[model samples]
Structure formats: structure tokens, C-alpha cells
Target: MAKAYRSVIEASMAQNDSTIDSTIDSTVDSTIDSTIDSTVDSTIDSRHDSTIDYAIDTTIDSTIDPIIDSTIDSTVNSTIDSTVDSTIDPTVDSRVDSIIDSTIDSTIESTTERRYS
Candidate 1:
């Protein structure tokens, strides 16, 4: 049982690490995209100052939205995969795992509080 639990925990950890890496990569990608987007927005804003057509704003948003949606989908898939790997184990009792998780959480929190106090 201990070995089984450890294996599950290891798989959970691997999934968690992958999730973290995905998040970091997504964040970096978003940051770069955002920076480029802001630059483009600024240029558009400047251009709009001359033309004054609000419809162009809608067009720009429509063009950019798909890219953003795809990024979101990728991030969501990583999250879902990690969640599936961790909490969706068939051999484990989810209720028992939840209890174990809560117990560990509480114990750690209590220990931290005692240390600070």
C-alpha cells in the first residue's frame, strides 16, 4: 500500500511539475504576446486618432481573439491533464484521499502557525 501510495504520489508530482512548467511557459508566452499586443494597440490607437472609425477596433479584436482563445485552450488542457492524472486515480478512494489531504494540510498549517507563534 505504501509503495502504491508512493507511486501515485510520484505520478501526481510528475503531473504537477508538468503543469507548473506549462504554466510558466504559458505565462512567458502571454507576457511576450501582451507586450507585442500593447505595442500594436498603441500603434492602432495612434492610427485611429487620424481616422476615428470605431469599427476598426472591433476588427482588431476579432483578429486577436482566436490566438488568445487557442492559448487559453492549451493552458486549460495542461491543467485538465494534470487534474486527471492526480485526482482521477481509480484504485484510490477519493474520499479517503481528500481526508488525507486535508489532514496533511491542517497538520502543516498548524506546525507553521506554532513555529511563527
Candidate 2:
């Protein structure tokens, strides 16, 4: 049981580390994309400052920024919720159940031994 618990812990840690790395890479990529989009918009605006260009810039900002923000927010929230549900909660519940089962079995065996002896 102890061995099993230790294995679960190690596996959970490895999974969490992998998740963190992936999340970081995803965030960095998203940030870079947003930055590049903004830079391009700025360059276009500088070259041709017109009402239509202004509207396009406004549309891009309104559309792109929120989409990026929403995507990031959803990603972070889902990651957190999944980590708690899939990893932390299950690990804790497993350990607790194991300990309880061990204790109960030990107690029952000892009681039966005393009666038989």
C-alpha cells in the first residue's frame, strides 16, 4: 500500500510538471502572436492613416484581444480545475481510502486473533 501511494505521488508530480511546461509554452506562443498582430497594425496605421484603416484597427483590437484573452482565461481555468479534479482530489482520496482500509483490516484481524487465542 505504501509503495502504491508513493507511486501515485510520483506519477502525479510528473504529470503536473509536464502540464506546467505545456501551459508555459502555450502562453508564450499566444503572447507572441498577439504582439506580432499589434505591431503589424501599428505599422499599417503609420503608413496609411485613414478612417477605414482606423475602423479596421478598431475591429482587430476588439475582436483579436478578447479572443486571445478568452482563450487564455479558459485555458488557465480548465487547467486549474482539471488539476484539482484529476490529480489532487483523486490522490488524496486514494491515500485516505487506503489508510482506512488498512486500519480496519488490522483491527478486524487483531480482534479475531484475540478471540481465537
lDDT score of residue 63 within candidate 1: 82
Clashing pairs in 1: none
> Where is model 1 poorest over a 10-residue stretch in terms of lDDT?
50-59
- Residue 54 shift from truth in candidate 2, angstroms: 19
Model 2 alpha-carbon drift over 4 Å, by segment: 1-75
Residue-wise C-alpha lDDT for candidate 2, range 31-77, written one tens digit per residue = 99898789977887777778788889899899998999999999999
Estimate every model's Cα lDDT from 0 to 1: 0.88, 0.94
Quote each prediction's TM-score: 0.31, 0.35
Per-residue lDDT of candidate 1, residues 1-117 (tens digit): 999999999999999999999999999999999997889888988888857666766776788777888899999999998887887764367778888999999999999999999
lDDT of 1: 0.88
Candidate no. 2 TM-score: 0.35
lDDT of 1 at 52: 61
Query: Which model scores highest in TM-score?
Result: 2
